[model samples]
Target: GGSPALGTRLKYQRARWERKRSRTAKELLETEYKYLEQLDLVLTYFVTILKAKGTLKPAVLETIFGPLESLYSASHVLSLHLEKGNLGAGLENFCQSLDLYGHYAENLEHFFCSLKGISLFCCTQEQVRKNKSFRRFKKLQETRPQFQGRVLEDLLCLPLQRLHQENSLQLLRVQKLLKGQKTQVLTPGRWYIREGWLLVVPSKGEELKRRMFFLFSDILIAAKPCHPLHPLNSNKLSCQAVYPLQQCSVDKVFGHTWSQGGLLSVSLPTLMQVLFLSWHGVSCTHWSYRLLVTSLSSGKEAPLGL
Candidate 1:
């Protein structure tokens, strides 16, 4: 609703500002040179502060997939809608309206601030990873609780690195993936070849299920002995096979196997994997997943129905 009005005013003001700035003095070469020097310094300072502005940092969003990125990249209006409103086709419509609103609406400074806090929120998650230091800081027991925002955010991410040394898992690659993403760019299909881990990226067309399907398929194809999602034993109902989930087998129908000229079938193994992963704390969000993936002992199921 706001894009058109904002667009025209922004365009006109920007053009006016540029024109005023570009007008040069015919007689004052020395003053013009100093003006250019000051302009450059001011521009540099703006860049530096914005870089530290939180949401713009790539390290803040590694596990959120590009969904967070896409949300931040939309017209500030649309991103706000996505975060606050329901998830569905309506948000997509707002994102698509970029053609009419122009980039100004999408690139508002408030949009950037929101992303950083969200990024801080994503990277500093305490539940899934459960690092001792992070847990200590997050709790009211010891560390000062008043500090929030990026200060606490980075403090939280500091412990994820320690997971590599303790767990014998290569978490450095994950850190690199988080760090390599540039300002305002959210890469959904980020896969680290060293880790052999492919994050399931969500697209505008696909919701949670499609991304999960791709992640499930990718994990199934890249199995090792006694791994969490190897799909070790399969029973076929039709064209599809049932891979009984390790836990939560009775909790929910994980996946259904399809048949030819017949009825539908379901697999329990996939459900177990999903349930097992969920129980261990892996999630679609960065903060939650970071906690889960960093400290997990691997292949151990949480006490579910037991």
Candidate 2:
């Protein structure tokens, strides 16, 4: 049997852990309520008004707000579950609805791409300000008690950042792995596009090297797993290179002999360098599409090679 002092210490630690868990659950519930309100603002004030007034075409609106209605519904149900004081049920509800988040994340690049195209073509701030519908909406937003002076941009950005926050646990792990590396920090307005393992093929008959790639709105980062021999760097990733999307062009390699995979050639004409990346299965096509969409959204022209 344990001594009285040991039992007391164990009880104290368990109580502390319980308090921390309780606090975290409460915080999650509170944030969910606020998040639901923001979603409501977008859906009610902006999306509904835009549709009712015929401000944008149906296809354009779909591109700009992919699966937002479904996301709002899922979030509403999750919030209701959380409000019922059952944290376990709330988590279960979220797990059942996880696909909604994945769908939103996958289509996020398209949303920004469509928004950028619109901005470049006809929806500049000056033009929007002069539009009758926008003026009316602006006035309504200003006077609406629920809006609380928040603009459309703020509400629109909420969904984008919500995914980033959802992935905070993975990011925390990444932070620990990159503790000593000089890595570019993720900043607001820079949206994550995609990430995956890829093979780097060399020009000569050299062996293929495996690399991890992270695609963002403006840049692509390639990293390599650190050597296992170094205890401090075990299971860590070391940054290999960062490529600016504006300076790069991607082309699909034709007539590849690989039975189950495809290749992409990322070229930097200014630097006279090309990176041959091989990806397995159908994900190659998906990554190529996302890269093009993200590059265009970042103000770069679509690659002529494509």
Report every candidate's CA lDDT. Answer: 0.27, 0.62
Q: Total clashes, candidate 1?
A: 13
lDDT tens digits by residue: candidate 2, 154-190: 5666765665564453234344445364775344445
TM-score of each: 0.15, 0.50
Best by lDDT: 2
Candidate 1 C-alpha error for residue 125, in Å: 23
Which ten residues in a row are the worst by lDDT in model 2? 297-306
Give the C-alpha lDDT of model 2: 0.62
Please write out the lDDT profile of model 1 over residues 1-306, one tens digit for every residue: 347766565455445423432231111223323333333332233223334543333432333222322322333343333343322222334424323222222222213335345633333444324444433433432233333222433323222222122112112212222212231112232211111222321335443221111111011112211111224311100111112222212222235221211111222343422321221112222212222332231232211101
